[model samples]
Target: MTAALTVSIVVPILNEADNLPKLFEHLHQLTAKPQQIIIVDGGSIDGSFTLAQSLMTEMITIQQSAIDWQVLASSAGRALQMNRGAALASGDVLLFLHADTKLPNQAMTEIALAITQAKWGRFDVHLDSNKLLLKLVGSMINLRSRLSGIATGDQAIFVRRRIFEQLGGYPNQALMEDVEISKRLKAIGKPACLTSKVITSARRWQQHGTWHTILLMWRLRFDYWRGVSPDSLKRHYYNT
Candidate 1:
């Protein structure tokens, strides 16, 4: 078997105290561990930074592994926080993960193989919900991403460190940073589109009503494509 790539997982967070424990547990259970895990907090007031620091300390002490775990504070924006984490990474590949998502078993091994074939890639995403419609939603999302070569952040996007830095990392926008970066990367080549799925929270759909959330996302993407500024879209997204 080929040696796995050195992967660094960068997770950007804001008020994710409730989800941090489970995310850490998932990391501990990975079939092939990452070289490091960086958690960048966006000035969360919910004690998220402290919790992340505590978890990192405990994980390091218990595992006694060489994995570098860092908890950093950044301005309150997903794009900015992710960029900060990426800047500190020291691995061959960087995987931007969401706190509410859980990678499947063998994710690191799968990514290692995928990276050999493409400069960047993303895993298929499965929404964690029992609703039949939500299951269909997840399937459609995966199919759409596969056909379009555009990845959403929830899919666990991974890329070669060199290429990522060359592209100047994610655009410092309030929204659609994933889509923007995917377009830039696709200009070089299509994404690997791995079959392994990352399970992500369905909280948005649950909170907003599945159909409503789906329609909102489609509308947002259409508006974004039509050249609507991310600042304008952000207000609509958060219903501000």
Candidate 2:
């Protein structure tokens, strides 16, 4: 087997204590180990920080083959937290992961090979919901991403460290930073558009009705593309 590439997985999290165990479990089971994993905690009120620390401690003591890891506390905001984590990353590639997402099998090796072809890329997404509507939503999400060369954070966006730096990192927006960054990356080169999928929580869609959430997302994207301010779109998104 080929050696694992040097990948720094950076996760921006908030109040994800319930999800950390599963997330870390998958991280520990990677066929190709990451160079390091950085958890950027966005001031979670839940015990997420403690849980992550405990998990890291346990991995250090029990695992013979373990990736280096660290937990950083940052102000609340996904874009801010992710940019901060990337600044501290040391690997050749920086992967921005959402806390509620799980990478598919061999995702690490896939990313390593992917960055060789493109400056950045994202895996397709699978929503962890059995609802037929959500399954279709997942398919559309992947198809839209593939057609547009844009990626979302839930898709586990990865990029060469130097290219990420060249783009000045993700735009410091209240929301839609991923879309903005993807646009900039696409200007330089098309994304790899890997076939592997990352399973992400469908909590938002479940909290709202599936169709309602889908419409809201479509509206948000249209507004964003039409030059709407992210701050305004963020208010509309969470309020809906």
The most accurate candidate by TM-score is: 1
Q: Determine which window of 10 residues in candidate 1 has minimal summed lDDT.
A: 1-10
lDDT of 2 at 203: 97
lDDT of each: 0.94, 0.90
lDDT of 1 by residue, 37-144 (tens): 999999999999999999999899988966788999999999999999999999899999999999987988888888888999999988998889999999999999
lDDT tens digits, residue span 160-235, model 2 = 9998999899999999999999999999999999989899999999999898999999999999989999999999
The most accurate candidate by lDDT is 1
Please provide TM-scores, in order, for all candidate models, with all chains considered together: 0.98, 0.96
Model 2 residue 96 CA deviation (Å) reads: 0.9
Q: Give each prediction's root-mean-square deviation over alpha carbons.
A: 1.2, 1.4
Stretches > 4 Å off in candidate 1 = 1-4
